[model samples]
Structure formats: structure tokens, C-alpha cells
Target: MSRWFRVGALASVAFVLVVLGAALRPLVLPEAHTAASILNAVEIGFAQDMAAHHQQALIMVQRLDRGVDPTVLRLAQQLSDAQRIEIGTMLGWLRLADASPLSAHPMAWMHTDAATSQHHSNTSHANSDAMPGMATTAELDALAAARGHNAETLFLQLMFRHHQGGLAMARVADELLTSGPVKETARSMFQSQSQEAGVISVLLTQLGGQAPH
Candidate 1:
């Protein structure tokens, strides 16, 4: 009986040890590696570029705010708020990545000469205006002069183009950059803006308008 009691006690102690080991395994072991860091890098780049792009859109919307169309005014306000918040978030990612938000060459990370060439070609002609998705001095002036539904229509049209330009930039970021906060931000932007673009499309239809083909 004494020997049996000792054996049972040892068995109970071993069982407790096993349970303790299992409980502590997670704390002692390293987590599984993942692409989270890589995604973060993409996010940072996406944020920076998208912020700059949104800035242009904001400027255009501000010019149209003086018009009398309530719908346009409301939409402009929404765009301004959403983009401003997103810009701040992107800037934060830059800080996290130790990257400068104000790089000398904007959109340099894109590495696509085609985009740059297109921007330049559009502005090459003496009378040609700023690139598409960019507001020119004359176009802004015209938008400022307009009022009522015409102003609303114009604002929607310009904003639609601006969003499309941003979408393209986001796509490039998603494809190219790897690692860090930039990648994560890029993925987020890709998902979020894609959805937002759809919503914008719906709104355009409701307003008796359509996004450029």
C-alpha cells in the first residue's frame, strides 16, 4: 500500500508538470513569422503617394465649394474629411518607416516612366493644361465661375478622375513595394479605395452622371 501510494503521488506530479509545460509553451516560443512587416512597407509608400494625390483632389473640391449645389458641397465635404484623415494616417506610416514624407521626386517609387511621360506629354503643348486628374489654373477658374447643378456635375467629374488616378498609384504600390508599414498601408488603401470607388460610381449615377470611360 505504501509503495502504491508513492507511485500515485509521482504520477500526479508528472501530470501537473505536463499541464504547466503546455500552458507556458506559447509564452516561451517565438511566434510564427509572417508577411506583416513586408506589408507594412508597402503601406507606407502607398500612404505617401495617395496623400499627395488626395491633396490635389482637396484643392479642386475647395474651389468648387463656393458653388450653390448642396449635393456637391456635401460630397466635397466628405471627400475632404476622408482624405485628410487618410493623409494623416499615411504620414504616420512614414514616421514609422523612418521615411521622409516630402521626397524630392514625388512618385519616384512607382518606377514607371510611362506615367511620368504621360504627365509630361499632356503638359507639353504650349496651350495644354495640367495633366489629367490634375486641376489647372483655368479649369479651377471655370469651376469657381460655375454654379448650381453644373458646378456639382463638374466637381463630381473631376473627383472621379482624381480617384481613378489614386487607384492606379495604389495598384503600383501593391505590386512593387515589400516589407514594413508601407506595404500594409498599400494593401489597406487598395482595398478601401476600391470599395470607395464603387460607392462613388453609384453616387455619380444617382446624380445623372457617369465616370469617364
Candidate 2:
């Protein structure tokens, strides 16, 4: 995609962020949601899917620290800590709404056709599996075995793709989810991950690595 296209996309996201922020006055209060006493499909799906997505990121970050350059290690730690905290937040949402942590159909929350949902559910990167940026089992195995400069480059490559995929989902959540907390959280992901992906792209080139295939 062109840079202008990307900018326009994020601009739309920012508009949604502003809309959601206005919505927060009424929506942020847990009491308001508690009175509603039920979670909608979008809310349930986002929390469940995103929590699993965050878990895979934590697993990937753990491998980025050892035998890597200081810069890469710092980024790895940053990702680890941020993702861990976000995971807690997502789980808290699930608990607050008394929803199950796992859903039977993974990307059904994404509102795609039945064929797409089945495809996502069967994708093996995770159990609740339907997110674009998750590493496959073989890729994770390669990540585990890598070290030194190789590890740094591979990690940057993988994480760049990961964040891009994650941004897509976050933007979708911003559009689809009604809950204030969920929208705020998704907006944060959209902004943070967009910035992080740019950084990762630079780092990958600095390390003489190719962009994600």
C-alpha cells in the first residue's frame, strides 16, 4: 500500500478513536456495563481472540532477549512488558463480563463468511487461532533455534509482520466493538503497533534483513 493510503487509514482510525473517547463518558463506568449484564458477540470475540494473540507475542519476545544485540533486546523487553500488561487487561474484561476465555469458533468474531471462520479456526498458530500476524509452529520453532545477529534480524522481521497483522485486527475492533474500554484498548493497539512496525522495519533493514515475505 502507498504511504498516503496508510495515512488515510489511520486517519479514519483516529476519527473512530475520537468518537469512542466521547463515548467513554457513558461507557467507561463498569457499573453501566454491569447493569447491561451481558457481553455482545464483538466484545466477547475481541477479548478472547486478542488475549490469545497477546500470548503468542509473549512467547516470541522471550526468544528475542538471549544472545541478541542490546537494541534488539531492549525492544524485546518492551514488547514483552507491554503485551503482558495488555493480556491482563483483556482477561480482566472477560472476567468482568463473566464470559468464557475461549470460544468454539475463533474468527467468527471477525464477521467473515463461514468458510473463512472455519479456515481461521483450523489455523494452528494458536488454539483460539484466528489472527493474521501469529507465527506458525514451524516459524516459532525456527525462532527458538535462532541466535545472535540472525536472531535479531529474524525477530524484527517476524514482529514487524506481527504488528501489521495486529494493527489490522485492532482497527477492525475499533470499528466493530461497542464497549468503551474495548474501543479505547483497540485504539491504543492501533497507534502503538503502527509506530512499532515502522521501527521494526528500520531495524530489519539496519540488520541487512529482508522485509517479511
lDDT tens digits by residue: candidate 1, 35-146: 3442243354456667777788778777784745565577678878888888888777677667777655555555456544443442322321222355567877877777
Task: Indicate which candidate wins on TM-score.
Answer: 2
For model 2, state the Cα shift of residue 104 in Å. Answer: 1.8
lDDT of 1 at 179: 51
Q: What RMSD, rounded to one decimal, does every model reach?
A: 8.3, 19.3
Over the stretch 152-186, how does candidate 2's per-residue lDDT look in tens digits?
Answer: 88788888878867876777777676568888898
Candidate No. with top lDDT: 2
Error of 1 at 54 (Å): 1.3
What are the lDDT figures for the candidates, one per model?
Answer: 0.66, 0.79
Query: What TM-score would candidate 2 get against the native?
Result: 0.74
Once model 1 is optimally superposed onto the true structure by TM-score, how far is the C-alpha of residue 148 displaced, in angstroms? 1.0
